[model samples]
Every structure is written in structure tokens, then in C-alpha cells.
Target: MLIKGYDDGPLVAGEPLMTRPGFWSNHLMGMCDDGAGHPVPEWFGDDGADADALSEVLFDPGHWPVFRVPAAEGPGVVVVYRNQPGDYGIDYLLTPPGRSSTEQLTDWEGDLAENGLTWHELVRIADTPVHEAEGAADPAARLLLVLPLLNDLDLPAAAPARLGAALAAAGSPQDTVTHTAESLLAHLMGRSRHDADWASPLSGGY
Candidate 1:
């Protein structure tokens, strides 16, 4: 959740929750093998970084940073690398909000065939690591990239694609849609069959 930290409440698509920040103990380092004898900037850590510090690294072209995207339930958190790690275009880590349990999503490698994603297309997307941009962690853009996979999983696009055209028309190509926190929450509650029942539709009904 960026500098504000996790809300422990709930998260929905297009809600603009901040991605997980890189850590000194938990942050990502530069992946380039500069072969420099001295320590590269990528070797450093910024685990408990503040907003201004994170902003600096996020916009720096030299770093191959990792960004987080919260699952609609918030119980699961998805972490992705902005740049390709060699032939693979992206790297991912899945865990709970606090990262209690972790799973890496490297299926895009041999698992691509099973998941139905084209290696060529993935490689193309990887070529331009979103982290290098100012809005590297834009919730809207992230949704577009991962939307196709939502149905197979237990998640939702809090903002939904209904606003895709409008977001694009507004000139933010990275943002697939725009949504308010309440809208996202409502979207999740209305559409997520798995999670919708967490609370009764009419708990207050007589």
C-alpha cells in the first residue's frame, strides 16, 4: 500500500492501492550485471523507506524494481518485477498481505503453455519494464496486463473494464480503468462469488 501501509480492511481493483515498496531487507535490487568491482546502487536496500525515498527509486531508470498488486481479498498480495529477468519477461511473488506465505509465479516460463499466454507477447511486454516509469505501479495499467487471468483465480477488477475506454481517452494509457475505493469494494462484493458471501446480502433483514 505505498507509504500509507496496508489498510487491513479490504482492496478492490482500480482502487489505486499503492504497490508494496522495495525493502532494504525486502526491497528489490538492480538485476544488471554491470561487472563493476565496486558495489552497484542496486546492491543497496531500503526496506522501511518513506514516500519521498520510494518516489526517487520508482522513477529512476537504473533500477529494476518490484511492485505489488493486492488481491481483491487483500489476503493475497502479488509482487512483480518491472524488468525481465533474462529471457523471462517478468517475475512474481504471491503471499498474504503481510507476506506470511509466499509463492513465486514463474509459470510464464514452462507454465505459459498451460496458462495460455504467448511467450512472444510476454517477452514484448517485458521489454519495457513499467517500473522505469513514474506510474510504474499504476493500478489501472496493472489490471489490463493481468485481467485475462482473473477469471481462473479468486479476484476481481475493483474498477472493472466498464471504464477502460474512458481511462484511455483521458490519456493515461497505463491506467486501464479508474475507480473509487467504494466503487472497487462494491464491485468486489457484487461480483466475487467466492468472497461475496463473507457478509450476508441482507444481514439486517427481518
Candidate 2:
């Protein structure tokens, strides 16, 4: 269910119209003129113009676009926004149960504690080693580090082992890591049940 901006209103709860095993979360943000001369908020100061534009396009209701992604476990909010000068941005905000009325770091911290580690420890384990690389690092390599850490901490695994294998085969260790992190997040934040409802998309297919 979707709740629009700046209002305190009741949410009509029901099963989602469609249920997939996993999906992407997209959020939109950016700076634009809005016909005014002043610049909108700068996400990266000067390097965020494209991001801003993307946000505007995604959030413009006239287009009435609904993002479709793989299904996830817990409840989440999809955020889309437009900035000054007509820029846009998009991303998914996972809203786990009992975390908070508003999505915030405190909610994240609470989940971290619910697992075996403090927030600091979680962050430390998730941190990537500093290195200069030509392109983005492979996600699977990062997953190798993350999955083990989450396992060691007794955190619930979000993505199954199959997803990891897919990342490994695709040559993106970081994607594997990202998939693992998402799974961990889903598990900690209470989305695992939802994940279980769908046939494992990454199952043997991965």
C-alpha cells in the first residue's frame, strides 16, 4: 500500500496485488530550478545533476509509474522525489516491524542489537577495505566477507545460498555481498516471512 506526502492518514492494509520472491527498491532525489533561479539541494554538490533529474522524472505523478522489483520480506516504502531545476532520484526504504513510526537510524540500530552485535560491530564487519580500483569492486567478494560475518553473528540470512552462487558465477562478488546484505536486512527487519512465500527465484536458477 502507498501513503502519499505530508499527512497523517490511515493505511489500508491488504495483500499486495503481486508477489515476487525479491525486488529492487528505488528512491528518487535531486535539485532543479522549479522555474526559480536558485539551485535545488545538491546531493553531491556538483556531480549530482543526473541523479536529480532522474528523481524528478520518477516522482512526477503525471507519468504514474509504479516500480516493479523482486519481492522482499518485511514492509518497505518506495520513495520518489523531484528537486529544483527538475531533477529526480529514487530508492527503496525498508520499514521493518517495530523499528519506528518513521524510518531512521535508531530503527537500524535496534535491529543490529536484536541480532548478536552492536551497530558499530555490524558496520565494522560490513566495511570494505580501502583500495583504489579501476571500476566498482566485485559484489561477490564483498558478499564472501559479509555472509560469513552475518553467519558468525547469528543473524538471519536474507538471500539464500543460491543467490550468492549466482553472484559468484556472474563475476560480481559485490552483488553477492549486496544480495547477502539485503537478505540479512530482510531477516533482521522481519521480511523473511514474506521472502518464504514466493518460490525461491534464486533457488536452483542461481
Candidate 3:
């Protein structure tokens, strides 16, 4: 299940399609600060970890890199960006070809049901403008959001190379942080297989 959106605002209403320029432009300049010039978070480091991660996506991009937490429905990656200035909000993306069905793609409540899970979760709900331009007639289609709290999710031990360290250095974990990629993946897959909607409230995970 792939979940993607921008921090400045919700994704374009309709197809959820975003152009490469729209995606990469803000990333190239690093995070915006409106005009306050806020310091980068300690986890991001002086070298700008967020920008560096975006670079990785641009160059050796694959299925997108799934970080820690919430496990994964299949195989994919999570991409983040700071689209707006002075906004504490962060954009998160769960790439595709992973989950068994699209229904789970945007489900947030379903992710919290994992046993022993910590980290906070917030879903941004962007309403469709009065004059609709991007999305469909359905009210659900106009809502644009991302799980910014994922930054605190735990990382798997053998996760790819320095991915664990990167996540830690970025300060994404909120608790003891000891879940593995394999287990997370299995959990997501399992939830998808069963009737886990009982765990979530929203009709669509979006």
C-alpha cells in the first residue's frame, strides 16, 4: 500500500498523481522555514539528512525505502519532504507494490493496532477547495494527508545498510525502538490478510 502527500498541502485531489518537478523541486532546496530560520532538528544533522535522503531517491531510487515502524504490507519505501516554510508538518510517502490491496494503502488506524507499538500518529486532513480542480466529486477524494508522526517509529536491526543509524540519527524513534524489518513487513502483510478493519475507524485508510 502506497501512501504519498506533500507537507505544504494535501496531494492534488484527483488521481493522487504528482509530477517529478513538483516532487523534487522543494527537496532540492532542503526544508523551508517561512522566515523564522529555525534550526534543523538534531536528528537531521548539519549535513541536512532530509535533503540527502531526497537525493538518494533521485539517484538510486527503486521501490522507495521503507523505514522503521508500522511494518510494511509488501516491499516498498517511505519518502518524506518539507514542502512548506515554518510548518512542523512533514510529508510522508509509502510506495507501491507492497500491500496486497489498495484499501490498506492509506489506512492509519490499522497501523496503530500492532502490539507494543509506541510513537504518536497524526493524520492531516485537507479539505477540497470550494471550486474543485484536482480531485473527484467524492468528499474522500479531496482529503490530503500524511503520517508525520512516523518519524518516531522503531527501526529493524538488519534493515538495509546504515538505515537504522540514519533513522536513529534522524531521531524518528520515540520508545525503546527494537522492531525488525522482517517482523514489521510480516505484521503489515498479516493485517492485510485478515479483517483488521476492526482496528481502524476510517472507511478508507487515506
**Which of the predicted structures, 1 or 2, would earn the higher TM-score when compared with the native?**
1
lDDT, residue 199, candidate 1: 30
- Model 2, which residues run further than 4 Å from truth? 1-50, 67-176, 183-188, 191-206
lDDT of 2 by residue, 72-150 (tens): 2232222222121333222223233333332321112112222222223333322432234111133333232222112
**Which wins on TM-score, candidate 2 or candidate 3?**
3
Ranking by TM-score: 1, 3, 2
lDDT of 3 by residue, 93-112 (tens): 33333343222223222133
Candidate 1 clashing pairs, residues 3+ apart or interchain: 13-158, 22-27, 23-26, 23-27, 23-47, 24-45, 24-46, 24-47, 140-176
Better lDDT candidate (1, 3): 1
Q: Which 10-residue span in candidate 2 carries the lowest summed lDDT?
A: 20-29
Q: Per-residue lDDT for 18 in model 3? A: 23
Q: 47-158, model 1: which lDDT tens digit per residue?
A: 3344346545543434444444444333222434333334433334443344444555332332221222222222223233335333334444444333222222232342
Candidate 2 TM-score, C-alpha based:
0.23
TM-score of each: 0.31, 0.23, 0.24
lDDT of each: 0.32, 0.28, 0.28
Clashes of each: 9, 42, 12
